[model samples]
Target: MIEGRMETRTAILRAARTLFLERGYAGASVRSVASAAGVDAALPIHYFGTKQALFLEALPSMPDYQPLLEGDPDDLGERFVRYVLEEDGHLRPLYLTLLRASDAGAVGEQLRDLHETTFVAPLESRLAGQDAELRARLAAAVVGGLMYALWVVGDDQLLAKGEDDIIRRYGALLQHLIDDRL
Candidate 1:
């Protein structure tokens, strides 16, 4: 019974994540997620309370390249960039959902709180040796810019070339901006 429940929860989350990314909060309904998950419409609400809650539950709570953060900073940057360029990178979908939600006042505030608490806090911890707040903010800006550029440009040519290429180009640019400013 417990195993079956867990499987259903996982399915709901998977469906919710996909639909939320594809349709944003406004367009994605609890019914839609439940249908996608092959469950009753009320299943989402029963498991997660509300559509917004389910959406947050489905969002990436951490970057997928967490192990890289435990290694060298340079290596981390390369791995992070590579992960970003990879098909269906965890960060990209969440980033897109948040960006889309930002247009709705209440949803935007909710997204901001969720991001600052989960996303930003983790990155800030990774930047601890680099003067904490400054490094974190700089890193956030760089990531935001890169994500926005990738979304707008609709191509990963620059990102897909190689991790070495991303590091040599964007990493150097980011390091100069942050290190010099610090």
Candidate 2:
């Protein structure tokens, strides 16, 4: 009975991920995801409490940024770019999903909270001097824009550039934002 419940929960989460990716937050409903998982609509609510909670659970876990933070400050930018482009490549689809659903009420709030906890807060802690919050947010924007351009928009020019070239160029920009004082 316990195993069965776990299976049902996993199925719901899996279905939620698929539907959320395909239809965005506003379009995908608990009923639809439950149907996709072959479960009753109430099951999702019973297990996850809310659609927003289910959506958050369905997202892939974020890559650890500790290594980048712990690394030499001089190389932090390049490390971060490489980490996102290579190590966290699998998260591109998830990022796209989040971007698509970002404007939805609950999802938008959750996204902001996630961003603050996952990116801004951690980076801000490491930053020194004035405008640390602004700098952290700027760095996050650079990464977000890169993901949008490369994965979402599929920019030809950016795609044409070798990964190394992008790392070197964008890395410098991120490094400046991270290390420069306001």
Candidate 3:
């Protein structure tokens, strides 16, 4: 019974993650999650109490990005850029979901909180300037804009550039932000 319950929960969560990413919080419905999970619609409510709770539960644990930050100051930008560009990176989907769901009330608030705490806070701490937090946020905006162009907006011109060229050029931009030289 316990094993079956666990399987059901896992199925529900997997379905929820995919739907949340595909449809965002506003569009992903419990019935749809249940349909995707091959379970009854009520199953999610039984397991997670609410769609918001289910969404939170379905959110993957973020991978540690500290290695990117721990490298030499000069190389930190390249490292961070490369980490974000890695093939089949896991965090991208989570990030996309967060961005898409960011205006959906409580779930959006939680996603923003998770993003700031998990990703931005550490970067802010690494900065040395006055208003380091603000600088870090601005850096996030730059990086986020680039990411949106590449991943969300599908900007083909940006995508056509060779990886190394993008790294060298954009890495400098990121470096300037990280160093608080911007």
Give each model's whole-structure lDDT. 0.71, 0.87, 0.81
lDDT by residue (tens digit), candidate 1, 50-139 = 777787778766554446556676545555555566646666777778888777665677766765765456666766354776675676
| TM-score result, candidate 1 | 0.68
Better of 1 and 2 by TM-score: 2
CA displacement after TM-score superposition, residue 130 of candidate 1 (Å): 8.3
Cα lDDT tens digits for candidate 3, 58-123: 977766767766668677777777777774667777777878777767777786776687668988
Q: Give the distance in Å from residue 148's predicted Cα in candidate 2 to where it truly belongs.
A: 1.2
lDDT of 3: 0.81
RMSD of each: 4.0, 2.3, 2.0
In the predicted model 3, the residue pairs found to clash are none
lDDT of 2 by residue, 107-135 (tens): 78878888898889999999887899999
Instruction: State how far residue 53 of model 1 sits from its true place (Å).
Output: 0.8
lDDT of 3 at 33: 97
TM per prediction: 0.68, 0.86, 0.87
The TM-score of predicted model 3 comes to 0.87
Runs in model 1 deviating more than 4 A are: 1-11, 64-66, 74-79, 86-88, 103-131, 153-166, 177-182
